[model samples]
Structures are given as structure tokens and as C-alpha cells.
Target: MRSVAAVLVVLGAAGATGALAQTPAPASPVPALDERVVVTGTAAPVSAGAVGRTLAIVTADDLQRLPVASVTDALRLLPGVWVRQRGPFGSQTDISIRGASFGQTLVLIDGVRVNDPQTGHHNGDLPVALEDIARIELLAGAGSSLHGADAVGGVINIITRREASAPTARLAAGQYDLVQGAVAWRPATMGVFQGASASVDRSSGFAPARDFVHQQVRADFRFGRTTLAVSHLDKDFGAAGYYGPAPSQEWTTQTLVAARHQRPLTGAWSVTGDAWYRTHGDEFLYDPRVLGARANEHRTHVVGGGLRVGGRLSSSLRLTTGVEATGDWLRSWSLGDREEARVSGFGELEARVGRLLLYPSARVDAYTTFGSAFSPSLAVALPVRPRVKWRASVGKAFRVPTFTERFYTDPNHRANEALRPEQGWTADTGLDTYLGGTWVATVTGFVRRERDVIDWVRPDATVRWRTENIRDVRSHGFEAFARGQAGPLALGAQYTFTRVETDRLAGLSKYVDDYAPHGVGGDVSLALPWRLSTAARLEHRRPYGREAWTTVDLRVSRPIRRVTAFVEMANVGDAQYQEIRGVAMPGRWARAGITVK
Candidate 1:
């Protein structure tokens, strides 16, 4: 309690100083929205103001200003999104959107799908370092029509840095015996742009068997209209009590090699293509200290590619078409060996008429194992006024059962091969309003109706849990957000409410029912004198079936010539809370670091 009060006092003082030192900019007579380009919400790049769906854009500047330890931490600034981490510094993380399960979200890097084919548990294992990112885009709600499977809830795209820049290095150390170092360089020569980065982070255990080591390497080259990137990530962490209540330890390594090409043809016409390969290896020990104890080893490989073309049909009409193919194979001692392949094609049209915009898209996917499925979506946007817009969308999405949910067998769990794909429909409507040139506010309401929702269930406590498909389930939610900037200060706030409806069946066990019913989050950033800056964040959550909790984080930094020093404090209240059940989070930990250019 005292710690929380102290943090509040410090923030209050900083706010006062900021207000006195800087004044707000004069408001424009007729404010106009910035013409920001976004590619994630549609088949072709479009202005953010024209997109009919809810989207959040996090820029490189935002990443540098936030005191986040990992890419997932920075995502919390957006509403209707939840990021759960078991350890610090990208050790282990899970992301969910709008009350959906973790597996329903899709992750992409440089426009290539990175979601693991075996399971969504490893989707957050991004291979690129923070310094290598150019920007991140989050599109909420079903995106299956634009991106193939695993996009039931939303999509997150992490774009890599490509601009020419000087080389920079960073080093940091802090509590829990943490040590980290990174270097990034981007240079253009002979009509070619080249970028490369490497980083490593390690920390001693805060508790027994809670240590971790993370390493990454990335390289990208661009010549003319073609670009190629390759990245590798290695992560080894003590996963004690991470899965269920067992004292488990695990190690994992991932490799990604991808290439992309784009060429502009005639007026308003372009072609793009991408190919990538990924491999992941996992080893788990039920008890590290007990020799010959139960253990599992698995290795999975995924290869995929896609080609797309877009052109204008008329002055206000555009069309895009694409084809994609993906293959997944797994070799494991416990789950045996298996393979599956899929082919998909999609098309979309964007038409504008006066003050109204319309987008319609459809996709057909043929899977070797599960036959075929078709998904479609329609979205519309209407301008209520010059500064106000209303948007609505409806879409269908699906998810195939993962290998771990089908064939794995253990003492405490069993898999079912008869499980079918989960299918659902999502609908949403929202309004976006711009107040002057510095303030923006949005409100959105959404509902999801699903059939054959997958879940693990057991008849009794003494029996092992088995995978099954539920008959029907429904979820609805709403989110509100506001953000503004004034001189050297920036402020943002978000709130969300969700409700789930399902039939109560006897002897049915449930997981992922731990989503928060209500959540409120806010952030503040101020630039003080002498190249000094400060940021603070607060998050409050009220779960459906668990205790509610609030957390606060603060950071301060100063830049001096070629060197910058910064310090961050997390869980300033020293609150004891568990994001994942039975996994205790750290409290009141402090870290400081320096960067040189």
C-alpha cells in the first residue's frame, strides 16, 4: 500500500512540472485525421481512417518510450487484449483477445505467418529482437477471410526495421542477477539496404528453477523492389509450475527463414509474394532433479508461401487476389510422427461511393486431414461527419485441432483424434471520433457465436482430462479507448467489459474461463527538462472466477549525448497476483540499463 502511494506521489509531481514547463498546442479550427497507412486490416494498404474494423497501431517511437521488457508487454497499451507472462524478459507468454482462447490469435512477422502449426502455445516465440522492429499492428476480430486459419480472434503483425540508420549497442543489468546486451545496424550501399541485429538476455532464478536464457539473430536485405529476411531464436527456461501444478523444466529453440518480393506494374497495380520455413524443438522434464523421471521430446517443422496481386478496377474500386499453401510435420517420441498439408485462395474488393466505403472478402481452404472450409467477411464504413465515422463488420473463422490435442498421451491427460475443427461467426460495430488534431476516441461492441468449441474435460476429479468439443458457446464484449497528446505530455486510457454464455453440463471441466469480466488500463508519458522523460502505467482487472487485482509500473530515463540511461520499476505496490493460475508473478523488481549510439 505504501509503495503504491509513493509511486502516485512521484507521478503527481512529474505531472505538475510537465504542465508548468510546457503548454498545449493551439487547436486547429477544423481538425483532420492523420493519413496513416495500415496494411493488416485489409488486402491492400489503406488509410487508417478508412478501415472499417478496430485496429491499434504501435509505432517504433512508442516502443522506445514504453518501459516494457518484451514485445508482449508493449501490447498491453491497447484495449480488448490480454497478455499473460509466466517469467520476465520474453521467457514465456500467452496472448488472447476479446475473451477468446490463446490459440485463437494469429501472429505474423514481416507479413509471414509465424504461428506454430503444432500448437498456439509457442506463437509468442518471436525470433526478432526489440531493436529490430519497425512497428506493430493489431487487428481485432475475425480475420480469416484475409489471413487463413488460426485468426479466429485477431491478428498481430510485427514489422521489421528497414530504414538506414547508424549502429547502436545496449547493455543492462538489474535484480534477479539479470544481464542483457544487444546491437543493431542498418545501412544502405550500392542501391541496397541491409539490416542486422543480435541480442542476448539471461537471468538467475528469482526462485528455484525459474532462470532463463534468450538469444536472437536477424538479418534483412532489400534491393530494388525485393526483400529477404532470416531470423533465429533460442530460448531455454526453467518452467517450474508452468504447466498445471508439476515442477516441470523445459527448453525450446526456433529457426525462421523467410523471403519477400514486391513489384509495381502499371498504374495502381502491384504484385507481392512471400515464402518461409520454420522449425521448433521442445524438451520437457517433469522433474529436473529426479533422474529418469518422465520426460517428453518433440520437434516440429512448418513451411509455407503465398502470392498476391492487387489493381484498381475503377477510380473508386480496387481488387486483390491471393493463393497460399502450407505444410506441417511433427516428429515426437511421445506423440509419434504426423503430417498435414493445406491449400487456400482468397479474394477481396474495396469500393467507395461518396461518403461510404465497402469491403467484401472470401477465402476457401482445403486441408488434407479435415477436408475444406470457406470463410467470408463484409465490412462497411460511413462518415457521420467530417470528424466522426461509424463502422460495422461481420466475419466467419475456423481453427483446426493441433497435434498436441489429438495424439499426445500422458498420465494426467489424453488426446482425441476424433475432435473436429472449431468454427464461429463474429460481428462488431464501432464509432471513431477525432477531437481536434491531438485527441482520438473509439468505442466498439462485438459478439461471437461458436459451434463445436474445443475444450479439455473430465468426468471426475480422479480421471485424466481429455479433449472434447462443446456444442455451443457465445461471448459478447465492448471496449472504449481515448488518447491524446499535449506538448511534451501524452495520455491514454482504455476499458473493456465481456460476458460469456454457455450451458452448464454435468461433470464438465473448463479452462481458459479465467478471462477478466472487466478491465481498466491507463498510461502517461512526460518529457521533462535536460533530456529527461518519465512514464507510468496502471492496470486493474476483475476476473470472472478469480480474485481481482491492480498493478502499477513506472520508469524514468535521461539521454546524454551518445548515451542514454534508464530505470524501470514493476509492480510498485508489491502486489501478489497470479496471471496464470498457481504461477506467482514477481513484485517490486527494478532494472536499469544504458544505450550507446
Candidate 2:
């Protein structure tokens, strides 16, 4: 499972040598930024330019042009986001934003929650295939005012395509005997459209217990105002240093089915409703050869639904209200069988006066076992100039401990049933402006004050780690990004700095303190003559109180008739680094592929 990253550094540089000198092509159309209406930040359909919060949108074109293999790969390029990966290609990953814990970030598909109830470690286990995705919208702040629990840091929403385009088939092979094949098909674009995608990927182990095999299947149906989708993900990967001391093996499967529809009434009134059901199963073997090494097995099922009504009452006022309910059931070997149910109600009002926009929203949630809480937020956006906009938001967010954090017991860790729900207040203000007619630059400062922060702590090396509400913690950060597209060159860059302060404690904390204190990244794509082009991504991450490391990935591709051929190098610098402590990651990987459309 080894990759040849360092050996191919010259290959990437050679592709871009004379590519940008020959000709200067025309850039894209008028909208330097996207005009698509986003739904993650608000109940109303708000355009990217009008959003009052820090939001980043990765469109379909960006997905195809980037040096990435999966949706997670594309997400790593944005600002205020951090991805801690245990496996190289396909495996468990934890996503955090603006210094929040993994469990604090919310993951959703078409506005339906998909966060695992057992643990946040599995939150990255998305069921939908990459080919089925249309775009990914990320909101990098508290979103509990409209969405329910587990939205402390921000929200990630995956939007699927509604209409059909061209069918695609792709095949690729790389080092470590890695093999991949994917196919996407969508029939008709007008009435009653349907789409489906399937993909299979496998690789030999980079090290002991490091091999992985992943598969995904998804189908979607759209007719009139109704949309339906079903997806499943299966994964078998080496847990290795992911959990305890021993090299572990784990297998997981996730399936989700959802349905949504909307009805438009007279005089700017509408109603929308959605329902979803998901099931996940996981089995782990700490070590099959060792006697009493301890193994864990778990299964979880989630059922959720929501109804929303209201719309534009006039040109100046828009109102939306909704009710949501969800149930979670878990069965585990060491965590014991547990279940919980929650119901929530929310309302939002968007008022517009002249060039100013105001948004106010509130939600109340009641849980059978976790009691009730109210979350309220307000956001404002003002156009200081024709090309400049000022935006700011303030809100309260909370997260109830996952079942694993409260009751799961393992050889290396213990749970605490006395843990309390974590809560925090979030606020941010930023300015978005058009620079030099081609660049869209944004700079923002944000902070969060959290109470009863949760973590697994052990006083020393002898005792097992246990869950505890480690008093108070304050996290603050600054984020900035500049993106521009002119002629044949498309450029993007982002910088982030975060500092986490915690009350003095006896033991070391597992995740609350283990964070990337600083990050800098950028993406560059250049179109060359004769359909030959190259793209590269650079990432520099500095772990808290540790040496920093940098990595880059490059891809070069060209088209021939209906097919496109490409080659890629991951971790181009061959930097040896670990996203998590005690875990070792491979250096320098190369792959090649062709796509037929």
C-alpha cells in the first residue's frame, strides 16, 4: 500500500513548465462568484453574494477540475476547516471547523441529518457516492438556530443533482495495487428524471492492517416537486493505530433513504416536507490472535422527518416555520443498548429594507432523556459599497454527548453517564469584497466561549481515559481567503489561525487540545493549449505544540474525443506526518485514470 510521492515531484513541475506562457484564454462568464441560492445558512433561498455568514460553495465544475478523488478531498481546500484522516484514501476521518470538536460539527444531506449516534469518529462515513453529488455547501459557524443539536462549529450540506446530464464511466489504477472503477447514469432531464451511481475501490495495505476496500451505491428520483434518494456505503479498513494500542481491524456499513417534496401556493406561500431513515453497523477486532484483547461491535438506526411552511408575504418580508423530530437507537457490545428521541420546532424571518438585510431565527428542542433547550440567532448584511458587503452573526449552539461518550467501555477508555451537554455562544463579523474586478476576498474573525466542554482525559499513563466535562474552554480564530479566475488561470488561497484555551486540568485531553493551531492552503488550475491542463493543491498545517508539515498534490489531464486521460500525485513532497498521534501516514502516492463521458 505504499505510494511514490517524492519520486514524482519533478513530474508535476514538468507539466506546468510552459503551459501558462503560450496563450491567454478567456475566463468564465460575468459572475466571478457563484449565483446559486444556498440553503445551508438560511431557510430562504439566498444567493452566495447575499449570505450573511461565512459560507463556502464547491460547485460541480470545481469538483471536476480539482486534484481530488472524493468529496472529502475537495473539502480539505477550504478555510476554517480541518480534516484528520487515519487512512490514506478510504477510511475513517474526523472533520472539525474553527477549533470545534468533531462531534460539534453537523453533517447533512439535502437538509436531513446523517450524524452517527454512536460516535463522531464515524461522522465522515457518508453513504452517498461522489458521482451522485451536485455540489457541497459548507457553513463555518453555529447553525443550531435552525438545524437542531450537534451544530456547534458549523454545518456541511451535500446537495444532489436534480436534472440529468451525460453518463460517465471511469477506471483508474495506482500504486499498492490500488484499483478503482466508477459509473454514473441519469436518464432524461425534463419530467420524472432518475439518476444512479456506483463505485468500487480497493488497495493493498500500506502497512500492517492498513489495507482498505470501499464501495458506494446511490440512486435518486425526481418528479415534479418531489425528490427521492437512497444510498449505501460499505467499508472494510485496517483500524491500526486509530483506537487503542494494538493494530485493529474494523468494518462498517451505512445506508440512508430519504424523500422530499414541496407545494407552492398562491401569493408567495409554500410548504415543504422531508423524511429520512438510516441504519449503520460496525464491527471491530482489536486483535484476533491475542486472547482477551477486547473487541467492539455496534449497530445504530435513525429515523427523522420535518415539515416546513410559509414563504414571501411581500417584497420586503419572508417567513418560514418548521417542525422536526428524530429518533436514535443503538445496540452495542460494550456500550449497552440505548435509545433516545428528540422533537424540535423552529421559525425564521428575513426582512429586507433598501440595501440592508436582516435575518432572525429561533428553535426549541425537547429530548426524552436530555431535557430541553432553546437556541436563537440573528444575522445582518449591509452593502457598504456597490462592490463591498459587511456581514455578521451571533448565535448559541449546543451538543449532547453521543452514546459512545456516555456509556461505551473499552480496554483503553471508559465512559461517564454523568456527563452534561456541552453548550457555547458563537459570534463572527466579516467583510466580503470584489478586488481588482476578478478576485473575491473575504476576511473574518470569530470566537466561541464553551461551557462544560467534553473530552476523554487520563491523569497519567497507568489509568484508562474517561469522559469528563472539563469545565470551561474558549476558542477563537481568524480566517481569510482570496479567489480569482482570469483567462486560463484559476487561483485560490486561504489562511487560518486558531487558539484554544482550557482551564488547567490534571490529565491530558484527547481531542479538545489536539488541534491544528495554524493552517495555510491554496489551489491553482491552469488551462494549457491543445486541451492539456494541470492543477495542484498545497497545504501547510501546524499542529498544536508540535512541528508543522506541508504536502502538495498535482494532477495533469487532457481530452481525446469523448474521453479524458489524467495522472495524479498525492503528497508530492513525501512528507512523513501523522494527522493523529501514534498513527503513521504514508508518503508520496501516484495514480492514473481515464474518464468517458
Candidate 3:
């Protein structure tokens, strides 16, 4: 009743001021990447075409046509990235890029790191609501030279939606007693340009022991040159066969408090700084099917901050330098208590020479336990022709062992206290072709050589899995995209191919061999008369040591005055697959919803 009342109130308000609503931009899964500004690959802002790196951008316009309960739904349509879910609505999802392990990818909100120190499994616990996102930037290769550590694979940076669009509310209900609701307000007449959003999702279950609930509340405030944000996320879900071959349940919560500032100092120089604090709590029930099974509780606290000062040294050159500090503490029922700290200083220079652009960066990090490490990167972008650009980049990246890998243990698992850190070098080259807004295409290839790769392994299933640093591992992949619009029909397609190799321990390891070797996905949208539209997504994947599967999702929406009605069907093909062995996936799940703006 509350959800309905909220929607009705929003509808009434929207109807009373329908004429004042701003129309959104055209929807496209693949925007003009050549002109978009990306900050994920580098610490500073740079045009995607000039970054000389593989960067993927999902704009606000793209989110309009997506059937997204969480950002993972939208991310699934993109190439070079993999999103594996044990349940729907982001109950528990593992995210990786270009065949990197889940722990290798770094997740950030407005440049604040959100990667949990407890385990990479909790890295996807984003506190910000999906409706509050303005854009998502993904850098597909090494990023540690700029982002510190745990960026061995890539980086994902989510930029929030701050511009006033409209006060909106949404309510949805669907399969398995699913229910969802969200509301956002960004008043045009505000004292300090404030925005707030709250959302929730609940599902009884597709099957027994598979129920889930997710809730989020966030607020943003901007005053002069400073911005502040606060957010909370709570999720409780059944984890049937997610961790092991047993029925289980997990509950997790996170709270984020962050602040950012940017100001002009003097002359052609400027300074920017940010600080953030986050707390996460988790309770995991291991195996309910087994008598005397145990449950573990964990509480984690993190604090991070950075200060950067930069300016235009010359018309052809730009310089930026910064220092960062981060610390994390974890208290666990079984793993005991532990803490770690790191401090780093970094610098970058962006220079232009004739038709060529150069980016060079370096960073040094001092760790409380592992001593010090150095990271460096260089990149170049060149305009080869009127409608073509060539780009390339080489960088060094690293990752430290998570507390779970180093200390956590149970009947089914054992920790290796003497675990070692992992480091890798990656290089990539790509070409972009564009012509106005009608058509755009991109092709990119990358390779990574890594050492001391970490993995949990056991000689046989009869023995408990143990954490070990495999001596050597290598990976290479390529991603391509072609997108265009003609008349009322818009089409976009992307494909990615990856291969991973491990020497000595080759092919026998338990989890490191599960990367997808081939993946292809695409989307099509058609505009119909009477403010109606339809969109469809088709994706195919072939896991390295697993079977291949394909799934298709479709959505249709119609606008009536100030309200929009939508129906979405996921896994329409009913593909039988699992992100992990023994896990179950939904088949042909459907939902219908209405949005008032």
C-alpha cells in the first residue's frame, strides 16, 4: 500500500506539472565513445578517444531503456566484462573484466574506492542506488599505476546523477512474489542543490531457500565547490550452493559517508581532494543441510582520503600529482581481528604533440606489511585519419591478499597465513572509427603477464580447499563493438574473446580455469508510434571448462502522460546454466512496473 500510495502521489504531482518535465536524451546502449570524457583509466579527466586505453562508457541515456533492478543488469549487455549472479536483483553478483578474477577489478563511487578488504566476494555491495547513476566508466586493463592496489584487472567508476531531471517514483511486481520500489527527488529550487533517492527490492524466492531482499538509501548535497554524500545498503539473501554444495543464507550491510572538494587555487593551478569512510557487516550461514554446521559474522571498517594539486603547465602539457592514504580493519567470528594500512603518492602528465597525445604516470605505495611497491604506465593516442584514431597503453598493476584469503578458515576451507601479494604487467592497443552520430565502431586487444597469482586449490574434492599463490598465470583478450541507428530502429552488438594460461599447476586448479573463453552480446531498440518502444538483448557465453549457454531478455514500455509503464522478461530463452557449479539460475523471470516523473 505504501508503494502504491507513493506512486499515486508522484503521478498526481507529475500530472500537475507535466509541461515542466524535461525530455531525456535519445537512448542508446552504445553512445559516441569517441567524444565522451572518461576518468576511470586515469585519475584525471580525459577524452575517451585520447586516453589510449580500452574504456567503456554507459551514459544516463542508456539506462533509460535498460531493464535494471541493479546496475549489473545493464553491465551484462556490455562486452569484455562478466557479471555472474547467484540470484536476481543483485542479491549476490561477482564482477570481473577481461577474464580477471573477481578480486582483480576495482569498484569506485565518484572516485572513492569501495572494494572490501574482507573478500572480493563483497566488492559488488554498492551502496548507491541505480537510479542515482549518471554514468558508468569501465577501464578494461591495468589501473594500479593510478588507483593504488587491487586494480590488476580493471576499474569501474560510477558517476552520480546530480542534475535536476524530475521528481520520480517507481513500483514493480513480478515472478516469485517479487516486489520493488524506488523514489528520487532533486528539487530545482534547493538551497544547496540537494538530491536524494531511496529504493528496495524483495522476492519470496524462485525456489526454496532462495529468497532475497535489498534496500538502499542515499543523499547528496553540493555547496559551492564541495560535495557530500551518504548512503546505506542492506541485503539479505539465500545462498543455496553459492559458496559450496549446500543450502545457505547470507546477510550483508554497508554504510558510506564521503566528501569531495575542488577549487581554483591561483594562476592556472587548481586543487582537488576527497575523503570517505565506510563500514560493512556480514553474517554467513555455511551449510544448513549439514548437522552442526556453523555460521560466521564479520564486521569491517575502512577509511580513505586523497589530495591532488594540478594545473596546466603549458598549452601542450598538463601535470597532476597527488597523495593517498587508506586503512582497513576486519573483525570476524572465526578469522579473529586484523588491520592493514597503505600510503601512496602518484603523478601524471598529459602532453600533446602535433597530432599525437601522450600520457605518462607513476606511483609508489608503502604498505604496513608487504613493504613498498612501484607502478608505472605510459600511453599514446594518434589521429590516423579523418574518422579514425589509434590508441595504445602499457601499465603495471598489483593486488594484495584479502583477509579472507590470508586468515579465514572453516571445515570446508583453510587459510594460508603466509600468502603473498600478486603483481602483473598489461598492455593493450585499439582503434576507433566514428562518423557523427549515425555510426561508431571500436576494436581493442589486450594481454597481461602475471606472477604469484593467488587461487584456492586442492588436489582433490575430498580435501579442503586451501589458498595458494600459483607461480605464473597469463591472460589475453580482445573486444569489439559496432553500433548505429537508422530511422526508428537502433542496433548495437559487442563480442569478447579471452584466453588464460597457467604454467606448472595448469588446468588442474579449481577456480582459476573458469573464465569465459568467448562471449557475445547485443541489443536492439525500436521506437513505435504513440510513445511506445521495445528493446531486446541476446547474449552467448562459453565458459572455459564449462558448457556454453545463451539467454535473451526483452522489454516493452509505453508512456501515458506523466507516467511510463514497462514490462521486462529476463532469461526468456530459459537457458539452463549456473555461475558456479550446483547453483541454480532463474528461468524466464518477468516483471511489470510503472514510473511516474
Candidate 4:
């Protein structure tokens, strides 16, 4: 295994040079970003034009032009984000943000929490089809402040396509006989509007058990002051022997419905009410006898409302304040009759003076299944010079036990309802700088200390694993990012270093022995003068208990009239590696296709 890994690393490096030579010239410069929203961190709204984080804006043009088979492919351009694909098609994706555990990250779809209430580990199995996405916002940091709850590491908000003024249809065909199609339309009157979209995708086997089928639909309508949306996603995936057993097939289904109403109050105040319902299903197996048949199903019902009122305190100062209320109920079939619910209320305040902004927020979580607690956070951003800025934040966050951790039961795992909630405090300081007109750099360092950390514990080989809380674990990390445009070509790269440790471990002296470390990656894209574009990417990561590996990928495309043709190479050198342990991923593969925009 070590020899195979080494050979792939060398091959990946050599292929980078060859891929660059075959790429196109370069495209025009990325526009000076404006209209970028900063809803992920500070309590108040911050635009990309005002704040300095390693923010990368990918426009609709960028999304449409890429030769992407899935949404994860489009996210590769952002710094501090890495993806591991198990096969040629989008069977499984392991995305890590800022070297944080996958379960620590939170994913939101149009303000609705997509993270499974049973286990955070299943959040990445987003059912929404990639073709339905309008835009994606990636906030790479501990976003416990603005988002509340599960956003300990980062937040990924996916915005779905809304009602457009025109109708559109897209059809695509690719390698391995892959086929996909999408159609959408919108029609509206003075007080009534309706929009809908449907899409389907399928592919032949690239490796054993690598075939997949996906279908999705979204429908929305607006009448008067009320709006409603309903969406569905279904996928059947053959994971092959990647997860230790051949014919390891998994199927997933998701359904969502949301409704909202908005009304203007006195002066600048606006009151809004929102509610949503979600259902998810998952089925997977290793072998019929050893692993047995496992199926998990969950449903969530959420309702909430909030009021926001803002006005000018003075010419230079702006004051914005709001209060919100939310209630959520979760039910799981795998939990053996267990149920959970939470009701929360929050308040926030923001103030700005000169080139500085400060925000403070507080929340009170009242749970029906567990006890309640109060959480608070504070943040500040200041521009020291025209080209430099400094920002810092301090906050407190907590994580409640999931249903799978407290009530689920299996032959290999047992539930522990006595588990205590995990609590933590985190702080970070960062600086952003722009040099000349060709380079931008950002550096950030953060430290987090958590108590009552939860982990699955095993007493002996004969006993089933159970959830337990361990005391005193600390983690710290730093990230450096830079992007530059030399002439017509755009280049960018980022590096991350992290250390995590627990004091309760017996043999290991430090927690760093178990955490991810030394993550470095870079991505570059160029657009030629002849309407042809090309992009290349490289990722090198070495985590604890694993061998280091580097991956190279490329994409090339040309447009003729309204049709665009392109080819994508993933793991161009066919690196054999694992993002998740015990999973043996496939080697080099390519997909070629064309799309009508």
C-alpha cells in the first residue's frame, strides 16, 4: 500500500506540468467584489467590499462554465476546502474545512438546517441535486456566533435557484455513457408567482459498484405576502468494495417544504415568519450477515419568526438589532421511539464607527428533552490602513447529543442517554492585506478548548460501542491564503496547520497524535482569448495515522454559440488514498461532456 501511494504521488506531480502545458492562455481579471454578503460571522451584515477575509466570489458565469458533474467540484476553487471523491461519479464526497472533523461543520440550505439531527456525520449526504443550486456561500472559520449551534468549524450555505423571469432547459451527456437533463420555468402575475425545476442524472460504472442515479424536483409559489417551496431528492449509489465489502449499495431520499411571510412594521422594522419540514432516509450494507441490514430514517419540523429594525444612530454610526424565536422537533426510526425538540430565542446588536464594526449577540436555548443554557458572542473588525485590516472574535458555543448517540441501538453500537452536552469557548485573530494590484494575503490563528467531549467508547472486544463524554480537549490551528492575477491568469493557494489533543488518553502523550496536520493545496484557472478556458488543481494532505498523498485534476472547455463542450480529469494521476479511514478510493478517471446553457 505504501509503494502504491508513493508511485501515485510522483505521477500526480509529473502530470501537473504536462496538464499546464496543454491548458489555455488566460481569462480576464476577477472583478472587484461587491454585493458579497457576510451573514456567516458578524451579527450585522458585512459586504465583501468592506471586510477582509480570504473571501472568494464565484459568479454564476463561473458556475455555468465549469465542467462539473456535482456541486463539490465547483467548491474546489475556494481556499481551505478539500474534497475526496470515492469514484468517477459523485458517489461519495468527503469535504474537510480548515482541517476540522467532518462532523464539526454545518450545512444550511436556504436558511434551513440540513444537518441530520441524528448525527452530524450524515450532513454531507445533501439530497438536493447540484443542478438546482443558485449559489453557494462558504465561510471558513468557527461560525458559532452568527449561525448559532452546530457551526463549530465552518458553515456552508447553499442557495437554491429562485423564480426567474424566463424559462430555461439544460441537457448534458458525458463519458461512461453518463446523461443528465434539467428544465425550469417561472410565470407570475401582480400578486401570484410560481416557479419549478426538475432534473435527472445517471452514469455507468467507472469501477465496481460505481454506478449511480439521481433525480430531483423543486416547486415554489408566492401569493400576496406569503411564499412556499417544496423540493425532493433521491439517489441510488453503488459504493463497490470501498467500504470493506463488495455490492455495498446505499440509497437516500429527502423531502423539504418551507413557508414564509414578511410584513413591514412601523418605520424601519420588518417582521418575518418562517417554517419548514424535512424528511431523510438512508440505507446501506456491507455484507448481509456480518454487517446486516441497516436503515435510518429521520424527520424534522421547524417553525420560527424574527423581527429586524435598523436605522442610523448618527452619520457615521449604524445600529441594527433583532430578536428571533425558533422551535424544532426531530424523530428518528433508528432511535427506538426516541424524540427530541428545542426552542430558542436570540438577540443581536451591531454598531459601526469609521472603518470599524462591532457586534454582540446572545441566545437562550430551551429544550424539551434536555436542559437549557445561554450562549453569547462578540466580534470586531477594524481597518488599520487602506490596504490592511485586523479582525478578532470571541464566543461560546455548545453541542447537544444527537439521537444516534443517545438512543440508537445495533449489534455493534449502543445508545447512552446520560451523555452530557459538549461546550466550548473559542478565540481568533486575523489580518488581511493586499499588496500592489496583483496579490492578496490573509493569516488567521485560532484556539478552542472544549469540555465534555463526546466519543464512541468500547470497553472490550465483546461489548458494543457506546457514547461517552471525556473531559478537557484543546485544539488550535492557523491558515494562510493568497491569490494573485499575473496578467490574464488567476492563481491562488492556501495552507493549514492544526493540532488537537486530549488529556485523558492513556498511551498517547498529546492530542496532536490524533488530529489532522499539514494540509496544503493550490488551484489555478485561465481563460484564453478564443473563448476557451482551462483550470488545474493540486492538493497535498498528511493527517495523523495516514500516509501523505497529493492529487491533480484538470478541466478544459470551449464554447461555440449557446452550447459549451468540456472534459474533466479527476485524480489525473490515479492516486489511491483515503479521506475517511477504512475506505479504499478509486484511481485516476476522466469525464467528458457538453452542456447547453
Per-residue error (Å), model 3, residue 123: 0.8
Top candidate, metric lDDT: 2
Count clashing residue pairs in model 3: 0
Alpha carbon lDDT of each predicted model: 0.81, 0.83, 0.82, 0.64
Using lDDT as the yardstick, the better of models 1 and 3 is: 3
User: How well does candidate 4 match the true structure in TM-score terms?
Assistant: 0.83
Candidates sorted by lDDT, descending order? 2, 3, 1, 4
Query: lDDT tens string, model 2, 148-198?
Result: 889999999988877667899989999888898899988785445488899
lDDT of 4 at 346: 66
Q: Model 1 misses residue 492 by how many Å?
A: 2.0
Q: Global CA lDDT of candidate 2, please?
A: 0.83
Candidate 4 runs further than 4 Å off? 1-35, 49-58, 65-67, 82-95, 127-134, 161-170, 174-177, 184-191, 240-246, 285-333, 434-440, 459-463, 483-488, 507-515
What is the lDDT, from 0 to 100, of the residue 8 in candidate 3? 31
Q: Report each candidate's C-alpha RMSD, comma-separated, in the order given.
A: 8.6, 9.5, 11.2, 9.6
lDDT of 4: 0.64
Which stretches in model 2 have alpha-carbon errors above 4 Å? 1-34, 189-193, 291-294, 435-439
Candidate 1 — which residues are off by over 4 angstroms?
A: 1-31, 190-193, 436-438
Instruction: Flag the better candidate by TM-score, 3 or 4.
Output: 3
Q: Count the backbone clashes (under 3 Å) in each candidate.
A: 0, 1, 0, 4
Kindly list the per-residue Cα lDDT of model 1 for residues 253-286, writing each as its tens digit: 8899988888888998999988889999888887
Residue 270 alpha-carbon offset, candidate 4, angstroms: 2.5
Per-residue lDDT of model 4, residues 467-499, tens digit only:
777657677788888766676577778888887
Tell me how far the alpha carbon of residue 304 in candidate 4 is from the true structure, in angstroms, after superposition: 5.0
